[model samples]
Target: MPTTNDELPESGRKITVTEAVRLTTNWRTYLDDSECDFQTKAFLIPIASIKNLLAINPDAEGVRAYIGLNDADDAMSGKLVLVPVVDGEDVIFLPGSNGDPDVENDSNVYDRSQNCPPDCSTPNELNP
Candidate 1:
């Protein structure tokens, strides 16, 4: 059973082509319905970054994605913030460069992902 999001399964499941297409189609519908002009279809995150985030806590179950905006007033500046999740909850990191585990801070999160548009996949079934 999935501990965090009820929408997600216990583990990664392989879906059929039809299912994949349906999911993508639904996502597209959402973008259109929401009037998302800057339809950011995907984000490119480095594997090393993910590894580093996971290294912060050996018991990390997974990384949670948070919708962010560079400029809170601008919806066009949409971005994805990644945070390590432990025990079905986000792990708040320490404040400052010292990286002390005791001190808690909300700013301690990852957002190295490149949003699609200028940085995107070569028109695949998912991003088409």
Candidate 2:
């Protein structure tokens, strides 16, 4: 489901605007089925207006903001989750040169579905 400006949370969205306008977030997703954990959620917000409303620099390059499921400050494990947007449309998160998902707590080859962040994009950029 898409998150419209009207649906923006009443709290935690630190930006405030005095004008009357509807800012709909162009929400996209790279949800890796059977991957990730309960500690996070990942998606793309591409609408320039919505980005501005969220206090992100609309002119800034790349998607650098992520909603934190634990802290609500757009990060998990002290890292920022960044997804890729090409031509204003969201693409799959590409992994950085280094990525290591933690399944060691109960590591199992069959449990590979739980490899967090889907082995794409660095740990923080793609993982929920």
Candidate 3:
């Protein structure tokens, strides 16, 4: 059976700092071992975009991020697409799909998160 909205928690669970560090460290180690050019350490999504996604529906519980590559041919161009989650299901807005004209500001999916390397933050335990 599928997880119902009522069965889901109101919010996500939290993790401790130690656990967070371990997860990040594991990812870093994997990236190093893989020796790939796409060394994306992190993605920075603006708060405005999040707000916009949330504003799409009043009942939105949260946002779900789907890892994606901007260009299928370019592995370095990795990206994350965010969609609003309502009742445990992704709420993707597809305006004007029924023969009507597309409206501006009718989109719910968001991308363009600043990736690390060029837009990385100052040296920190997570980014270092």
Candidate 4:
């Protein structure tokens, strides 16, 4: 079944327009099934728009966004889904013709705060 945007919960934290854009554009897959195809370009617009909406309000914590396929189309449709995570146990199903999208949450969303400067964590950083 396709998840409607109305079904998704609103974020509790206020996300900056810039941060939201970054989130979608720089989205890293925490987990992806081999079969699910990512429509990178197609999804970028919706991802950015949704992020912008979330950014308006701060304090919406634990909110993650993802782009998944609709069963009807294998191509990326730019459908942005707002996924909420609880203690990292949210199960997400990727839109597919067959099996439901795999579910995984919070524990999967990347933490930007922990990102270290290039030189701090990598040997290349030290050399550079």
Candidate 5:
């Protein structure tokens, strides 16, 4: 059975999606941490792409989506889907998934643009 970081052995590492799901059943907490609670909700990662992440970091902790750093007026919000890439004892966050149209065109203009980057001029690039 899979275990959370707090429940693992001294040499244990972060859990992968498969192991995480097997243990938690739901990916909500993982997803939430990645997204960083930016009023935006939900996360989407392709199953196939996970393999590349695994290859790069076999002991990766978990994926997270960056919701932008704090800025003036706290209006600088953007999404950066990431997968954990562990390098030795350091855990790095690697970019994963892309923007969703639904989020980009959300009824709330603030939330809409908040989810998209100003320089993001293209559609989401899906890994086929």
Candidate 6:
């Protein structure tokens, strides 16, 4: 089981990854606009390409992505949203540097373990 809201200074609330996914039922609603308005190829890592590479080389280092997916067994849909945390009534993903998309697009996916930056060395604290 994954930890959620490991160190949220904003709310100081602890959460589980399952709960976070449940809260973000509409995670994909704003993705189109966000991608169109502020996007760069830097943050657009193709999932298929990664899989192909991994298949060829089993020793390959896989991506450390934090994806927001709907857990409804009846309907399956998921998108590569950034690291998300339960904040109040909303579940939000951290935007890239200065509202750009390149930050999350990097090869290093945000590490969801440990506390946030300046406090803990765990990486990828985009919105913490």
Tell me, by lDDT, which candidate is best.
Answer: 3
Summarize candidate 6's per-residue lDDT along 1-128 as a digit string, tens digits. 53456544544467665665554433333544565332111133455545543554344333334544344441223334432122322222232324444654332233222221123332322221
Q: Which stretches of candidate 6 lie over 4 Å from their true place?
A: 1-42, 62-128
List candidate 3 segments past 4 Å from native.
1-13, 94-106
Tens digit of per-residue lDDT, candidate 1, span 28-58: 7898999866677677888877887767667
Write one digit per residue (lDDT tens) for candidate 2, span 23-110.
Answer: 2111112223444343333333335434432343333234434433434453343233344444675433222322334532221111
TM-score of candidate 1 on Cα atoms, chains taken together: 0.73
CA shift of 38, model 1, Å: 4.7
lDDT of 3 by residue, 34-115 (tens): 9977788889999888776666666887788888887888766778899888879876664354423364355567896877
The residue ranges of model 5 lying beyond 4 angstroms of the native Cα positions read: 1-38, 69-77, 85-128
Return the TM-score for candidate 6, rounded to 2 decimals.
0.19
Best by TM-score: 3
Task: Residues 21-106, candidate 4: write the lDDT tens digits.
Answer: 56544443321333445424222233554464345423334556564434446444334465444456442322232333343321
Structural similarity to truth (TM-score) of each candidate: 0.73, 0.20, 0.76, 0.26, 0.30, 0.19
Candidate 1 Cα lDDT to native: 0.73
Spell out the clash pairs found in candidate 5: 34-64, 34-65
Q: Which residue window of length 10 is worst by lDDT in model 4? A: 110-119
Candidate 1 or 6, higher lDDT?
1
TM-score of candidate 3 against the unseen true structure: 0.76
Model 1 RMSD in angstroms = 6.1
